[model samples]
Target: MIDAAEHRVVDCDWHYQDSFTDIVEYMEEPWKTKYEKSNWDAAGVKQNLSSFFPTSTGDRQAYGKIEREHSNYPDKAETPDRVREGMEFLDVDQSIQISHLALAMGGVQTDDERTQAFAKAHIEYMLEEVLDPDDGVYGLAPLPYSDIETSLEILDRVENEPAIKGACFITAGANPPLGNRKYDPLYKRCEEIGYPVVFHTGGSGLDDYVRAGYQEMLETHTLGFLESNMSQLVSVTCQGVPEKFPDLDIVFMESGVTYVPGLISRLEEEYLKRPEEAPLLEKRPSEYITDYYFGTQPLEVSASPDLLELCFDMLGTDRLLYASDYPHWDFDSPSTITDLPFISDEERKAILAGNAVEVFDL
Candidate 1:
């Protein structure tokens, strides 16, 4: 077995609760006052109208399909101390924290100004309240996806903060796709600042898949992540995002690694048939894909080891980063990678730590 003690294990993708109640306090005048006054409470229930996140899980908890039990200790991973304890338990040296509530910010929030305000409040809350680079906890600045100018501004705002590692582009319900020219400026800004643009997926039960009449939350939750990232992969690759910003680093989170090899093969097959369509791409789609990084949370470990080993070989072992997705229902532990019989000790160490260090410049 690969020894977790031998490496400064880095979790490239982890999530924490950015509750609206707490984030609202950091909002500016109009929004703060508006949210506070509009926030409603009842005998045994409460709701925040200003919450940017949609109610994606629906009535699963009400029916006992899911349980929300209280923990003996801090379980949200929302504070620096809680995060440090989590890292210790998982044998992780460093972690890049994503927001559990804000993961759907881009897809769910349509109001441009509200999106900007929420993004700002989230970054402010994380920077001031949660993030502690010295304690091995770091975060990505959540960007307002629709507002390019504000996104660029946020990038500049967090440029000097040591705990702010990169800009997070939520991809759950990205309209016009990520490869469009609308996102080019933000991508360019990321490249200029040496910050990788990490695309994080979210549950699609609230809007996209539901609107299409998909009743089951399980169906949407299972397929939503894969579909969202696959859509962007096609857009980013075909539109030559890598070519346009050669130095820019890209990372896709939440989705498992299995779809990558299949998607790349499909893209290459189509690219060969019609090279005229994607004129900007100088190499095969798979070739450019190998340059990007992917987080391995919700990793499909139930699959056959031989199949996984083949997938890893196709994608290159160095491109994979171990992500715990801790504090969530389906989080992976360090043993998930360490116990893999196919990967050698060195490769396991690289996946668990080394690749993340190089990807995020840790």
Candidate 2:
């Protein structure tokens, strides 16, 4: 049995690679042919996308090397050595890793072969490297949102796998809005299999945070979280997904909890004003919102201590989880959060591992 004290920390949000080549390996012959002929090279795509994030001064070259190596060894990111290193750095017992690039692959245009190739590659990588490991590392499987049948098929394949905790769908893109009935089948499958559905911010391709004509990476990264978090909330409420999948657990990743109170308040107010248009809910919108979970990181230190109390008061403590967002620039060190000011020691322990233990059934 895993000791709660020794194996207590569970990072709710960590990342893994989305190497195109790795994804392409599992593609059918036709898809592979299409991807090989595509104009956009994998390296170019990654470089262009990285420009939107804040990179360290000397890290650009190192990132280039890392990306290149990953492009070659698609499984490199999931290697045990790398996972262990990350766990040590964050002082966490286990990691629930989501892949931004892999999720993006689901949005790639399926009319062409490249899209098919991308899906096959991503699914194969998730199964072989990310989810098949016996180590403590856990994975969020990517779904091919472009094709619901395929997405459901993939879910069916991975849901029973012990290493896989849930399916990850991006907050934005060609994928249908979260509230659409089209997603009901997927949600139903998740509910049947007892796996959560996770929505991660970013990978919109067009950086919403990038100011027009302004190229500062820092500005883009900072503003990106705001846009992403708002979109996530909107997707859940405006799209009416919660009403459709009342039993399904949804996790909002990387987005902080500070905005949740205001969002839930607004949702409740709107529900009260327009009960005719929104008739599916059994309780107040805030009550439903409280049933969902939010993974926090780089927590707003100035206000989070008090905000933590506010969130528990409003959303309940079980609805909030801790995440380190490890290896990223804004990554929060585990030790730093171990003694967060204002929060009781018991609350801190719940955030660190107890909540995750219940959520993931770890």
Candidate 3:
């Protein structure tokens, strides 16, 4: 087992997936009955989520990567014992249990009520099976991005659950981006409770741009997943989210690092020219970007060491968090991320664990 007493290593973007049937076992009362009876709204929402992110696929022609976590029923990937075993194997201290079902919910065109019900059921399962009993595991509370009130209610219900360290919502399908007035209540509440609002990777934003724009699955999958973060990060920094909730810590996960510096430079130049348009911004856009934390996954291997060093510098050495994207085929080992020759030991340690400890307030 990895000795937590000596070194701290937190996998910031660990994932858990389930089919629609697996989720029903965790639901209570009305939600349970709805799933059992196949209530059109609730059942339909669950079906879509399950189909979108299954743990295993029969397609041999499946995209580039095919490796996935073992899918033993009951003792599946996200179970407490399984997580403990995974951390031990990976030499990690803990992992933030992010919901794959919740990630799919962001882009689905579903009723607000139904989505909220699904979100609650998903979180219920996460708390029971993956988070509550495991000290080495932390959770991100899934949010129904379609309805703010229901999301708030989920947070209220899970407030005393200390294992839930952050709130997970997707901005991929968000029309107004995430900085609009509609999401103010959530930002405010998260700030009050000292929880960081994490914007994880999701897909099919704004009329399914990726699918419509690209022909090949490889083409769409590669670019589609990362584009949403760029747009939303711009919206949050440029639209003055930081100014309104100064202490609200935000995270961008699964997105690569190159675009961050490019976008910040664009925003910086724009700020110098059009300061009046975005008056809510207190400092330059890059400073706000610095205040946020980002995940190091799908690492920018194409970049030379010098370029990687420059990107890390722009990102602020302490701001990047290391993630394995574990159990997925593309998962980077903690060593692969930390073993880089260009970075110092302290920088690698910060990326591996110290930064996550501060960002999640673990």
The top-ranked prediction according to TM-score is 1
What shift in Å separates residue 130 of candidate 1 from its native position after superposition?
1.1
Per-residue lDDT over 51-167 for candidate 3, one digit per residue giving the tens place of the 0 to 100 score:
332222122235424544442322232345666777777787888888755665667665535567777887787776668534678888888866888888988977778888989
Q: Return the lDDT, model 2, position 158.
A: 76
Note the Cα lDDT for every prediction shown. Answer: 0.79, 0.64, 0.72
For candidate 1, write residues 290-314 as lDDT tens digits.
8889888888899988878888898
Clashing residue pairs for model 2: 23-121, 179-239
lDDT score for residue 338 of model 1: 91
Better of 2 and 3 by lDDT: 3
> lDDT ranking from best to worst?
1, 3, 2
Stretches of model 1 off by over 4 angstroms after superposition: 40-52, 57-77, 204-207
**Candidate 1, clashing residue pairs?**
none
- Model 2: weakest 10-residue lDDT segment is 51-60
Task: Compose the digit string of candidate 2's lDDT tens values, residues 1-362.
Answer: 22234547988787665544455566678766554455434542343333222221123223444442223322233443565677765677878877646544433443544443454566567667665345568887766666778778788777777888887776645345666677778888988888888877654433333344435445555565556656656656666777776678888877677778888877778878987666666677677677788887766666746676676667666677888766554666565456566556677778788888777767
Candidate 2 Cα errors over 4 Å, as ranges: 1-7, 34-80, 103-116, 130-133, 206-214
